[model samples]
Target chain A: MFEGLYSALEQSEVITLYRHINPDCDALGSQWGLATWLKHRFPLKRVIVLGHQKMTNGLFPDSDEIDDETVRQSLAIVLDTANVRRIDDERWQSARQIIHLDHHPQIEHFADLEYVIDHYAATCEILAEFFSTVDQEPLEADVAEYLYRGLLTDTLSFKTSNTTEHTLAMASYLAQSGLNIPQINRDLFDVPLKEYEFASAIRAEAQILDEHLMISVIDQAFLDRWSMTASQAKDQVYQFGGIREIEIWAVFAKDHDDQRNTWWAGSLRSKTLPVNDIAMNYRGGGHKNAAGCKCLDDASLNALIADLRRRLKENQA
Target chain B: MFEGLYSALEQSEVITLYRHINPDCDALGSQWGLATWLKHRFPLKRVIVLGHQKMTNGLFPDSDEIDDETVRQSLAIVLDTANVRRIDDERWQSARQIIHLDHHPQIEHFADLEYVIDHYAATCEILAEFFSTVDQEPLEADVAEYLYRGLLTDTLSFKTSNTTEHTLAMASYLAQSGLNIPQINRDLFDVPLKEYEFASAIRAEAQILDEHLMISVIDQAFLDRWSMTASQAKDQVYQFGGIREIEIWAVFAKDHDDQRNTWWAGSLRSKTLPVNDIAMNYRGGGHKNAAGCKCLDDASLNALIADLRRRLKENQA
Candidate 1:
C-alpha cells in the first residue's frame, strides 16, 4: 500500500512536508509524524515540515522555512489536505516531486502520487498504520504522540461517527510506545479559565429559536470582552453541540471588511441535516453536516436562520 | 479467577445484584451487565438487580424491588461498592451467600468471596475481561453495551489516568459485538438544552480565587431557577474540571433541613492536590483528588477554601 510513498522517500534526499492552511491537530500530527519517522529511519535525509499557519494551541512546534532553491529540489509530501488550493505552502507547486496523503475525499488532485483514503477517520491513522507495518520495531514515544494527537482530535476523542474498531486498535498500537495518554488528551482539550468563561458566555447568550435550533451571535463588543477574533469566537460553536433538543446550531461572529463595512462570519452544524447547500447560497460552503458562510447584514443573518429552520422542517417532514 | 464466581453462579437458582447508592454509570453497568449475562447464560436462574436510587439520566433502567424472602434465599452479588455501608440495598447481609466484585481498593471483607482489582479503570473493565475470557463465543450485544458504558464513563471516554492499552483492547473486544459505539457515547453524554444553560451559568458564576483555585456557590434561588436539587446541581462540578490554571475547583450548593435552616453541600476536585482531608473535617470524605463535604455556614465554607489553598501552597513549596 505504501510502495510508491516509501520508494519516493527512499529516492529523495530532500523531503518537505505540507498540510492544509489553518492546520488542525490531524494535519500537524500526520505531517510531523511522517517527518520524524523519515528522519529516524534515514538520518541522511533532509526532512522539513513547511507551513505558514501556526497551531494556536501550542500543542506543536512551529513549521520550518526553506528557501525557494530547496523547495525546487525537494519531494513535497502533503498530509491531511484534500486539494492543491488548500495547501499551506504554495511553494509545493515548485517542488521536484509531490505526494499527497489525505483522509479527505478526493478533490482536484495535483500530486505526482495521490493517496487518499476517505474512510479513515484521520490522516494520522493512515500514517500510524503505515509506520507500524513498514518496520518491526515499535514507534518512538514522540512519533506515537504526534500521530495520536491528530487521531484524538479528528475523531473527537473517538466520539465521531467514523470512529471504528480499527481506530481504537490504531490508538492502542500508538499507546504501546509509552505516550502519556491522559496528559496528551488534557493538553489537546483542557481549556484555560478565560476560554471556559467564554464558553459559558456563549451558552448563556445563545438564543434558542426552537427545540430544534439554537444560535449565538457575537458582535464586536462580545469579541472585545473576550479579547478574541471573530474566527476564534466562532469556534465556540461547539458549546451548542451534544444537546438532545438542538438538532441545528449556528454561530455568527461580526467581522469587518477592508473598508470597515460590517459583515458576519457564520458557522453552521447539524445532527443529520445538510448545511453545505445553505452555506453555498451565502457564498460559502463545507460538508453536509457542518458548514460555514457569510452574512452582509442583519437581514441576511435572519435569512440564513430562516433557511436553516426550513431545512430542519424539511428534514422533519 | 472464574472458579469461585462461576461456581457460585452455577449453584445459585436466585441471584440478587446490588450496587452503591446514588449510583454512577459504572455501578449500574456492572450490576446490570452481570445480571444480563447470568440470565442469558442460565435461563432458569432468576437474576434480580436491587437498588433504591435511580439513574437520573435514564441511561439505564430502574432497579428491581424484590421481597425480603427472595433476598434471604438468594446469593447476593455486590458490584462496584467499596464497603458494606454504601451498598444501596442492605438486605445483602440476609442472603444465603454473598459475592463482591469491585475495582476499588479493598476496604473490608463483608462478602464470602471478594474480587477486587484496584488497578482496573472500572469494575466493568474487570467484568469485561472475566466475561470475555470465560466464554469462547462473543458476548451478546446487550451485555457488551452495558459493560462498555461503564468503562467509557469511568475512564471519561478513555481520558482518565488509569486508562491503559488494555482498556482500549477491552473496548475493541466489546465493539466486536457490533455495538453502536457512537450512539452509546451520545446517549451517555448528550445533555438537554437546560443542562447546557446550567453549565453556562456555572462557568459564568464561578469565582477564580487565584490561578490555582476556583469556586461556584449555588444558592436556593439558583437551584429554583434551574428546577434541580442541590445534589443534581452539585453534579455540574465537572464543568470546573480540565482547566489549566485551576489546580483545585469546587461547587457548594445550598440545601435546607426540615426546620428550613440552610446548609451547604460541596463537591471538591483537584488536578493533583488532596482534598479528602478537608472533606473529613467537614463530616465527609472521599478520594484524595475528589471528595465531598458539608459546611454549616459561610464561615465553614471559607475555612474549607482556606484549607484547600493551604494544601496547594504546600504542594508548591
Candidate 2:
C-alpha cells in the first residue's frame, strides 16, 4: 500500500516527519511510527520528527528536539495532516521532496506525493501496515507502545465507527509484539487529583448557549494555574457530560504564546452542529462534530457566534 | 439498506422494544425512537418498550418502563443489545415473534428476525433508517430528543469511532425537532458534588494490576451512602483520562438487588481492554472493551481475573 511512498523516499538520505496543528495522537503516531520504522529499516539514513505547533505534552511523553534547518535538502513526509496551512513546519518548502499519508477526507492536497487512504481507521493503522507489509523487523516494545497508543487514541480504543477489522487486526498484531496494553492504559488514563479539580473548574465555568448549544471560553486567566495542552482543555469539556441535545459544545482557550493576539484557540463539538463549516469560516477546519478555529478578539468571537446562531437557525428551518 | 429488516417486521401487529441492561441514553433512545415511530405510523398496533433489566435510575431523568409479561406475548423487538444470553428479557423464548436491531458486532443467532447492522454508528441510526423507510412522521421534540440522546450516548457525542456521517445527519435531523440539547446535557452529565467525593473514594479503592489494568469494585455500602448508579460508577472509571498505554480500567459496582451474595455488575471502558470476553466466561457478556458479569465472591472474581491474565498472556505469545 505504501510502495509508492517508500519509493519516493528511497533516494533521499535525510528524512523528517511533520503533522498538522493541534496535533492529535494519529498525527503524532503516524509521524513517530514511520520515523521508528524508517530509522530502524535504513539506519544509514538520518530521520527527524518535528511539527510546527506544540503537541499535547501529556500524550507525547517522549520527544525529539529537531533543528528546522538540520535536514539539508532532505525528504519530508507529512502524516495525518489536512490543509497545508496547518502543516507543522514551513521547512518542508525547502525540502527536496514531500510525501503525505493521511486518513482524513481531503480538503487540500499539500504534498508532491500523497498517499491518502480515507478508508483506514487511523494514521497509526497505516504506519503499522507499512511496517508489516515491507517485512520490517517487529516493533520494539516502546515503539510498539507508541504505535498502539496512537491506534487506541484515534479509534477511542475501537469504539468508534472508523474502527474496521483491519484496525482490530493491527491492534491484535501490536499486542502480539508484547506491547503491554494495561500499563499503556494506566499511563494514558491515570489522572492526578489536581487535574480532577481543574476539570471541575472548567465545568463550573461552562454555561449554556440557548438549548441547542453550550459555550465556554477558557481565558488564560482561568487556565494559567493549570498546565495543560489545548487537547487537555478540550477533553475537560466532556466532564460536564451528557449534553445529548447540544448541537455544539465549544471551548475557546486563549493561547498566550500565540504572537497573533487575535488567534485565540477555539474548539467546537456538535452532534447537530455543522461546526466544521463554522470553523472553516474562521480559517480553521475539522469534522462536523469536532472542529477548531481562531478569533482575534471578543468582537470577532461574537461575530463567529452570530454566524453559528444562523447555522443553528438553519436547523430550525 | 433495510429491505431485509423491513420485510421481517412488516406484518407484525405488536412490537416491543428491548435494549441491553443498565440502559444508557442510546439504549433508551433506540427504544423510545422506535416506539415513537410506531406510535405515529402504526397507530393501529400496540408498541411497548421492555427490558430484562432496569437501567441505572439516576442517569435517566425520565422513566420509560414496561413489564416482562408484555415481552412474552408481543413481537419482541430487541434494541441496542450486544449479546444473546444477556438479551434483557428471557421472554424471547415465548414471544410470538422475535426481531432484533442492534449495533454491536454479531454475538449470537438469537433473533428469528434479526437486523444486526454492527457497522452503523449507533442503534438510533438503525432506528432512524427504519423510520425513514416506514415514512414515520418527522420526529417529535421529545422523541427526537430521546433519539438524539441514544445517538450521543452510543457515539460518545460524535467523538468515538462509531460515529459516521449518518450519525451526524441523524443528530442534525433530530436537532430540527427542537428538544433542548443543553438541558439534557446538564441533566445527563452534571453529577452532584457528593458524587465527586464518591468518585474520589472509588478511585482510592481501585486495585492496580501492574499499571496495565486497574480494577475497582464498590460494594452496597458505598451505594447506600452515595445513592449513585452503576452507570455513574462506570463514568468514574472513564474519568481517569490521559494514559496512552493502559489496557483495562474497570469499575465493578455491586448491584444490591441482584442476589443475596452474588454481586451482579460489569465494566465500561474506552476499548482499551477485552473485559467483555472476561465477563462472558463468568456467565456474563458484552463488547471488546465494555462488558459485565457477576462474581459470586472475591474468589470467583479472582478466578475471572486469572482467566483474563491468561488471555492477555496468550496474546503476547
Candidate 3:
C-alpha cells in the first residue's frame, strides 16, 4: 500500500486528503484516519483532509470547510475516491504532489501515486494496514476508532461481498490498539426515536417487487407529515423486510423542497441486479453492489425504469 | 386507507391480524384497524393472528387471538403486535381463519394477516383520530399513508417531549378514530438502536458519574468492535466519520443478536445525569428520557449494573 508513499512523504512538505463527495463513513473514516496518523507521524509536514460534506453527518464532525492556502502548498492524498467529479473540493489541482488510496473497483486513478485495493472491504482497512506497515508509532484509540468506522461502513457490518479476510484482520489489529468498541457502536448506530419511526413508516410502505424483492418510497407529503429532514427520509428507505438474493429495493423521493428538483434516490441492495450500473445512467456511481444516480424529470425516470427492466430481464435470461 | 374493511362484506370467511409486541402504533392499526372492523364488518367467523409470544404492545390494540375449537367455530382478531409473540395463533390454533396486519418496526411482526405498513409514520395515525374513537376510514394519501403507519413507536415520530403541533394534529385526528396513539408510539419505541448500543457495551463497561453529570464510555472502539452475531464479527459496526461526542454520550447494546429483542436488551441515551430516572431500579421501569432492563440474558443484569458506581447513585437520596 505504501508503494510510493515513503518517497512522497519524504519529498512532500504539505499533504491534503480527499475522498468522494457526500462523504460516506468509509471515505471520511479513511481520510480522517490518515490525517490523524500523518499529523502525528510526520510532525514536520502540515497535514489536513479536504472536501467532507456529510449529508448524513450533521454536526457529527469534519466539516466541508477547506483552507484555500493548504491545498496550494501541500501533497494531496485521496482516500476511498472513485471519480474526479465526486471530489468534495476541486481545489486540489494546486497540490505539489498527489497520492490516492482507495478500495472501490478499479476506476481510473487521478493522483500521481494511486494505491487502490478494491479487493479489501473498506478504505479504512487499507489505511489500517498502511499504518501498521509504516510502523512509525502506535495508533491512538481515536485514530483506530476512525479506521474501524470506515471498515464497518464499507463492509455493511461485514455483510457485503466486498469484504475479505484481510479486512477482518485489519479490524482485529485496530481492536488491539485499545479502541473502545461499544462507544463507536453507539454513535455509529444510535438512531433517534424519530429515525426509527421514520424507518417503520417507510418500511410500512414497502411492497414486494419481484417475489424476491421489495421496494418503497417516501413522497414529499409523507416526509412533510413526518417532519423528516432529507437525510432521515433517505435513511428510512431501507427498512423493508426479508433480505434475500431476490431482494431488490428502491426508494423514489423528491429531492429537497424544490418541485423542479425531481431528484429520486434509490438503494439497490442485492447480488441479483447490479443497481450501480443503473445508477450510472445519471451522474452517480458506487460499487457494483450499491450505486446511485440522479434523474432530471419524469421522462428520464420512465426511460430509466424501462432500461432497468430490460437489463434485469437480460440478467434473468 | 382501508376502505373495504370488516363488515358483512360476505363474511370475510377467514381473517388474521398482528401488531408490534408491547402494543404500540395505536395497536388497533392491526388489532382494531382490521380485527374489530372485521368483526363488525366482515362475516365467516374464521379470524385469528399467527403467534403467541408475550411482550408490551404499547396498548393500541391488545391481543385478539382465539382458541383451536373457536378457529373451527368462530373468527379471531390479533391486535397491536409487531412480533410473533402476540400472534392470534388461534387462527392457526384453528387453521380455518388467518389474517395479519401491523406497523412493522425494526422488529418483524411475522403473521398471516401480514399486511405490514412499514412506510407510514404511525400506526395510530393510520387508525382513527385519538386513543378512543373508531369511525371513518383513512382517505387522503397523506393522512392515509401517515396514519397508515403513524404513532406506533415511542419517538412518536414527533411525539414525546420533542413533539410538534402538526404531529399532535395528525395524531389527534387519528386518535379520534377510536384508537390510541400514545400507547402505540410508546410501545413501539421501546429500545432504539443507540440506546441498545450504549447499554450493551458502553454503560455496562463503565458507570462513572461525576459532579457535572458526566458519564463517558470508551468512545467508538467498543461499538466498532462488538458483534451482533458470531457470523457478524466479520462485519464491523456502523462506519462513519468525525467521531463526535465520544467524550460524553450515553451508550447501550444487546446481549442478543437481534437489536429488537426486548427481554435482555440494553439501553443508554442521554446528555446528562437526568437519564437515570428512566434507567430505573425496580419493576424494570423508570422515567421517559432513560430506562433499561435485562432484555434476554435471563439474569438480573440490571441489578448487577445497579451496583456499578454510576447507576448506584440513581436511587440515592
Candidate 4:
C-alpha cells in the first residue's frame, strides 16, 4: 500500500512538505516525521517543511523558506490535509509532483497520488505503518517522537472514537525507538500556569442549565482579563468536557466590530447529540457532535440555548 | 513464565482474589481480569473478589463477602499489593495456598508463590501477557475491558515513565477482544460535574511562589464552601501538574484534630526534584517526585514553604 509513496520518495531529488493552515500538532508532527525520515534516508536530497504559521506552543521549529524555482524542482507531499484550499503553502501547485497523505475524508483529488484513509486515527498512524513496512531498521528517536506526538494528540491520548488496535500497534511500533514517552506527553499536553488558571476559571464560572447542558460565556471583560482572543477563549470549551452530568456544553466569547457593535462566536460540543443543525441556525456549522456558531445578540443567544435544550429533550423522547 | 500461575489455577478448585486496600483501577483490574478468566475456564470453581472499601468513583462493583471456612479451602491470589499489611482483607492467611502477582517493588516475602515484576507498567499488563500465553482463544470482552481499565489508568493512558513497547503491545492484545476503547476511557476517567468544578477551583486558587514552586492551601473556609474533606482537597494537586514554569507544586488542606486545633496535610509533587526528604521533615514521606506531609501550625507551614523554596534555589545553583 505504501509502495507508491516509497518509490516517489526514492525518485525525488528534493521534497517539500505542507500541511493545512492553522497547523495542529498532528499536521506538523506527521509532516516533520516524514521529512526527518526522508532526510535521514537520502542525505543528499533537499528536504523542506513549508508553512506560514508556527505551532502556537512554539514546541516545533519554524517552517523553512524556499523560492518558487526550488518549489518547481521539488516533489510536494502534503500531510494531514484533505482540501487544497486549506493547504498552508500553495506553492505545491508549482511542484513537479504532488502526493497527499491524510486521515480525513477525501475532500478533493488534488494530488497525483493520494493516500487518504479516514479510518486511521491520525496521519501519523498511517505514516508509522508505512515506515515500518518499508524499513527494516528501527525508526530514529526523533522520527518516532515526531510521529508519536501526532498520534497522541490527534486521538487525545488514545481516547478518541477512531482509535483502534492499529493505533496502539502503531504507537507500539514508535515506542521501539526508545523515545521518552512521558516527557513527550508533558511537552505536548502541559498548559502554562496562566492557561491553567484560565481553564479553571472557565470551569468554575460555567453555568449548568440542566443535567444535560452546561455553558460558559467569556465576554469582552473576561477575555481582556485573561489577555486572550475570542478563538482562544472559545477553545476552552474542552474544560467542560467529560463531565458525567454534561451531555452538551458550549463556550461563547464576545467580539466587537470596528463600529463597536458586539456579537458572540461560540464553540459547541456534545457527547452523543447532533449540534451542527443548531449551529447552522446561528450561521455556523461543523460535525454532528462538535460545531461552531455566532449569536448576534442576547436574544439570539437565548434562542440558540432553547434550540439546544429542545434538541436534548427531543433525543430523550 | 506464566506456567506456574496457569498450573496453580488449574489445580485449585476454589480461588479468592485480594488486592491492596483503597484499591485503584490497577489493583481491581488485575484481580477481576484474572478472576473473570478463571471463572470462564473453570465454571465449577468458586471465584471471589474480596475487599472492604469500594472504588471511589463506583465504576467497579462492590467486593464480595465470604466466610472463613471458604477462605481455608481456597487458593488466595493477592494482586497489586507488595505487602500483606496493606491487603484489604486478612483472610489470605487462612487460605490453603497463597499466590501473589504485582507490578510494585517487593515489600515482603509473604505469599507462597510470588510473581512480582516491578518493571511492568501495571499489574494488568502482566496479566494480559499471562492470559494471552495461557489461552489460545481471545479474551472475552468483559475480561479485556477489566484489564484495559487498570492498564490505562496505571500508566496514565500510556504516558507514564514505565510505559513501553510491551505495555502498548499488551493493550493491543486486549483490544483484539473488540471492547469499546473510547467508552471504557470515558467510564474510567470522566469526573462528575462537581468534581470538575472542585478541580477548577483548586487551580484558580493556586499561588505561584516562584518559578519552580506553586501551591494551593484549601483552608477550612474553602473546604466548607466546597463540602470536601482535607484529603479530598489535597488530591487536587494534580490540577497544578504539567505547568511549564513550575517544577514543584503542593496542595495543603486544613484538617481539625479532636482538640479543635487545625493542622495542614499536604501533597507535594515535582517534575524532577526529590521531595520525600522535605516531606520527612514535616512528618510525612513518599516517592522522590511525589510526597506527603503535615504542618501542625501556621509557623510550620511557613517553615515548610521556606524549606521548599531553599531546595529549589539550591537545585538551581
Task: Identify the candidate with maximal lDDT.
Answer: 4
Q: TM-score of the second chain in each model? A: 0.92, 0.68, 0.41, 0.97
TM-score of chain A of each: 0.94, 0.73, 0.81, 0.97
The DockQ leader among the candidates is 4
Error of 3 at A112 (Å): 2.6
| Candidate 1 displacement at residue A180 in angstroms | 2.5
Task: For all candidates, state DockQ relative to the true structure.
Answer: 0.65, 0.09, 0.02, 0.79
True-vs-predicted CA distance for residue A316, candidate 3, Å = 8.7
In the order shown, the candidates' Cα RMSDs to the true structure are 2.7, 10.4, 21.0, 1.8
**Which of 1 and 3 is the better model by DockQ?**
1
Query: Model 2: runs farther than 4 Å from truth?
Result: A6-22, A42-76, A82-98, A104-112, A119-121, A136-140, A155-169, A189-192, A217-235, A240-242, A252-265, A276-287, A296-310, B1-317
lDDT by residue (A1-317, candidate 1, tens digit) is 88888899999999999999989999999998998989889999999999998978987888887899999999999899987788998999999998989999997878899888898899999998888778887799889999999999998998887787778878888887877887898899999877877878877778987578999989999998889888888888988888989989989999987888889999999877889999898878998888999755888888888998898888878
**Which one is best on TM-score?**
4
Question: Which wins on DockQ, candidate 3 or candidate 4?
Answer: 4
Candidate 3 C-alpha error for residue B169, in Å: 53
Q: Model 3: per-residue lDDT, tens digit, B65-123?
A: 45455455443344445555555342444544443444445375333444355544445
Model 3 Cα shift for residue A50 (angstroms): 2.4
Pairwise lDDT winner, candidates 2 and 3 = 2
Off by over 4 Å in 3: A1-3, A52-70, A136-138, A229-232, A241-246, A256-265, A274-317, B1-317
**Model 3, span A123-216: residue lDDT tens:** 8988888788877555787788888788767655433445444654576567656565545555565565445446646755665543445556
Q: How does candidate 4 fare on TM-score?
A: 0.96
**Per-model CA lDDT versus the true structure:** 0.88, 0.68, 0.53, 0.90
Question: How far off is residue B99 in model 3, in Å?
Answer: 50
User: What is the full ranking by lDDT, best candidate first?
Assistant: 4, 1, 2, 3
